[model samples]
Target: MIPAIGWLLSSFLVAWLSARAAIAYAHRRGMLDRPGQRRSHSIPTPRGGGVGIVVASLLCLPGVLLGTAEPWPPRVLIGLLVALLLVALAGWWDDHRSLPILPRFGAQLLAVLLFAVASGVAGLSWWWLPVLVLGGAWSINLHNFMDGIDGLLAQQAMFVGTGLALLAWGGGQEALALAAGCLAAASLGFWCLNRSPARIFMGDVGSGSVGLLIFAFTVMLGRAGAWLLWPALILSSAFVVDASLTLLSRFWRGRRWYTAHREHLYQWLVRCGLTHAGGGVIYMTWNLLFAAPLAWLAWSHPRQALPTTMGAYLAAAALWLLLKRRCLRRRSNKDRHVAA
Candidate 1:
């Protein structure tokens, strides 16, 4: 317990101090995200603050090695580190200067491939490789898409990381627990400055890396016990439902779904006059009220995990549609009133 606490504190401090440095660096480099039609904040903010989280996450390796009685295979450890760095470096570069989509995506694909190969997922069967590649890439992109508002991604990262830590600890996976704990603690450190009226943005650097970490943790948990994926999925259902539904909606409407836009449900919340913090609270409320209980149920009753996961996502989808429609109507009404 003492060691775990120590690890968490160390991770928090690393992320906090690093994020502080990132703010200075961003200012020096002019890596500021200014307010615009597609943006949420009203003022210019420093971005690439996720460098702190990336640094903290990388520092988790020593703790993992020291904390776990059973160490990860050398190949797996090296593969994970390299993969994380690949994503972070790519994002960091993009934060400074936009990279073409093909190159950016190529980096993500290569990173995921390395992880799949080193984790032995590639050796399992022909089909597992594609699943891991596609799912890992999708996780990376979805997180990037969801990083629109201040503190939302950080808060979500903390929530999912803590939830995954508990699940890992319950399963006696000490290394995984430590990794997840570090992730949560690091996110909390960043969230201090990230929460509404933000001082800094996560930029591409942190969001895609976080997505990869979560995906990697889920893969580990699923390997521990396939049923464990249920709780993980339930924990992530909010972002999954929102991002997925929004993407499909855009694509179906013949819009360029791959392009950037402000169409997410959370974006709508801000458009409806909710503060970023308030929108964050709304998502957290769902996590606490809806996602948490369903995840607990899935964790406790492994046999019913599938049904629980399905039900949770179905409910989330319904809520997404309802709230999105409501937001649209509210915006329309406000527009009509202004025109009147």
Candidate 2:
């Protein structure tokens, strides 16, 4: 417990200072994002705020190695670290150079394979493999896609890390809990800078790293015998719904799935005249409303009932999306007319 607190404090300090420095560095380097068509922000904001994410995560590694997590086998940790490094490099490259989508997505695939192999994904039932792979792919891209607004990715990370840590505590994986605590703490500090009307943006590095970490954590927890998968999905349902639905919609319309666009649910909300803060609040609300009760049910019900609870959430998300999209279209038309 004390170790977790120590890590939390250190991670926050490092991430905060790093973000402040990145703003200046990007500004000096002429790396800011200027507003234009298909953009949300108005000013040329200094970007590449993922600097904090990389710095904070690297700082946490030493503590994880030095702490009680020692028994978790060095190779697995090293492999995971290598994957993160690859993603970080890819992210930085994307930030500076704007690498094509295929290459970036390729690196993410490699990371997913690395995590799967590292944690013995073979041990899981066959049914979960395709879902796990899809989930990993989903998690990575979803985070990147949802990074449109400031603080959204970091805020999502906070809730996710907190949820994983809770399940870790319940499942007696103390070391993992400590690691999650460090991440959650860093995310909070980063969120201060990332919040709407943000001082800095997360860029690709923060978003990719976040998705990678969450996916990895899920695998690790599943291996540790925690059956609380329902709650975990609930915690992340907002982003999942938006990204998946948007991608499917694009595919149905014969649009390329790999291209960047502004048709995401949150983007639609913004198009409908909701401020970024308003969208963030609504986005987070679903997580609390869905995850809280689902988490309780995950802990309370017998193992056999897990499927039923999870199914209910799937149905609910589907229904919510249908209604929400209709609402957005109506308001968005009005907004467009006003602008016209």
Candidate 3:
């Protein structure tokens, strides 16, 4: 318990210091995100602020592992570190140079595959091998897709990590929970520089690491039982719905389904005059008002999966309608938003 508070405070300090350092580094390196059409931010800001996130977490890694009974293997450490080095470098390259699509995706896939192999979580059977690869690839890609805004991915990651930590403590996974403690602390600290008009964008480095960490925790949680996946899925509902619907909508409109665009519901809200802070608050509120209940329901009645999933999906669809309509209405000069 004492370690919990210690981790939180220490991560906060680390994040604050790291953020300041990143901002200065970005300025000196001229790694700034210039404002433009389709961009919500109005001014050029320092990007790659996620470097701070990596620094803080890397610092906490040893602390979480020292003298632990269930120590992570050297292979796992090497795999994660090596994978991160590649992913972060690619992301840094993207932020600095608009990396071509195919190359970027190739790098992303290679990193995820190497990390999974390094962690020794290879497929269990011949049939499941392809499934495992596809799942890992899709999860990391979806994570990258969802990291389009300030505090969105990181905050959600923290929420899920904190919730998992709470469950681990209750379920006797003390080491895992302590690890989660470090992640939660690091996320909150990252938020200091991440909220509102941002000092730096996390770019790919922060978001990819976040996705990987959450993926790791989710796998650990799943080993308790498959039912546990529901709550974790619920906690991640916002990203799934936004990304999924955006892709589907684009497909429906005969647009390139995989190309970059600002048609996402959350992106529309920001474009429709909601400040970054306001948009983040709105998404966070929906997670609490809707997504959290789904998580609770999933945990409480793991076998009654259909109803719980329906409720969560319904909530997401309802929000999509409400937000999309509100933004379009604003564009059309409707006096106010209508509840769905």
Candidate 4:
């Protein structure tokens, strides 16, 4: 207990300091995100603040692993750590210079494959193996996609990490719980600099690495039989619903799905006059009001987990449709007024 508390404090401090340094470094290097057509912010802001998050998490990992009482297989722990490092490195590289689509995706795929092999997915049915690999890779990318506004990604990380920690603790998975706690603390630290009227952005470094970490934790929980996948899905329903629906909508319209665009419901809301912080608040509220309760029910009643999970997604999907319609209507009204 004492060691865990220390770990959390250390993690928070490390991440905070790292983020501060990253902001200064970004400014010095002129690694600023300039305002553009698809952008949400007006002023240039330093990016790659997620470098702090990635650094802090990795630095604290050894202590957390050693201090925890839970018995994790050495091989599994090493494999996960190595995979996370690879993903973080790739994201860090991309933040400095845009890697082409194929190379970027290839890196992600390679990391996911390492994760899958480490997690012993090969023992699963052939079909399940591919599904797990694809899902893990997609999870990493979807996080990058969702990181378009201030505080959104960081706050989401805090909520999901905290939820996972609580769930793991409830299930008596001490090691996993401790690790998740550290992640939550680190995210909270990052949020200080990442809030609206932001001083710095997380860039791909933080988003990609954090996404991979969450997916890895989910897999770890499954392997331990401490939690089911449904609850995990419910916990991150906001990102899942928005990213999935937006991608499908784009693909259906024959748009280049890989292209950068501000077509996400959250993005539309920002364009419709919601401040960046306000946009983040909406997501946090959804997690508290809708996703959190359902996640709790799923965790407490494993038999009902699947249905509750589906219910959460359905509600999120409905909300997305509603937001999209409202955004479009507002645009149409402005257009009509202009014509008048």
Q: How should the candidates be ordered by lDDT, best one leading? A: 1, 4, 2, 3
| Model 4 TM-score, all chains together | 0.96
Q: Could you give candidate 2's per-residue lDDT for residues 135-238 as a string of tens digits?
A: 77778778988898767788888888888888777778777777777778788888888898998888887788888778877777776775756555666767
Per residue, candidate 4 scores C-alpha lDDT tens digits across 1-340 of: 7888888988888888899999888888888999999999999998888877777778877667555676566666676778788888888888887878888888888887777776674243444567768888888999999999999999999999898888877777888888888898999899999998888999988898888888888877776663466787799999989999999999999999988999998899999888998899899999999999999999889999888998999999999999899999998898899999
Residue 90, model 3, lDDT: 76
**Residue pairs in candidate 4 whose N, alpha carbon or C atoms collide under 3 angstroms:** none
TM-score of each: 0.97, 0.91, 0.87, 0.96
* Alpha-carbon runs more than 4 Å astray in model 3: 62-67, 72-77, 118-128, 257-259, 333-340
Model 1 per-residue lDDT at 144: 94
Give the per-residue lDDT digits (tens) of candidate 1, residues 1-340.
8877888998899999999999999999999999899988899999998888999988876558444787656676677789999999999999999988999999999999898887784233445778989999999999999999999999999999999999988888888888888999999999888887888999999999999999988887777777788999899999999999999999899999878788999999999999898999989999999999999999999999999999999999999999999999999999999999
Least accurate 10 contiguous residues by lDDT in model 1:
119-128
Clashing pairs counted in every model: 0, 0, 0, 0
| Candidate 3 global lDDT | 0.72
The numbered model that scores best in TM-score is 1
lDDT (tens digit, per residue) of candidate 3 on 1-340: 6775676678768867887788888899898877777566778888777766677767776666443566555555556666666666777788777888788777767776666675455322344335545665566667777776777777877787787776666656676677777777777777778777676777777777676666666655655456776777777777778877888888899998666667887788887787777778887887888888778778778787557977798789888888898898886674333432
lDDT of 3 at 138: 61
Q: What lDDT does the true structure give each of the candidates? A: 0.90, 0.76, 0.72, 0.85
Clashing residue pairs, backbone N/CA/C < 3 A, model 2: none
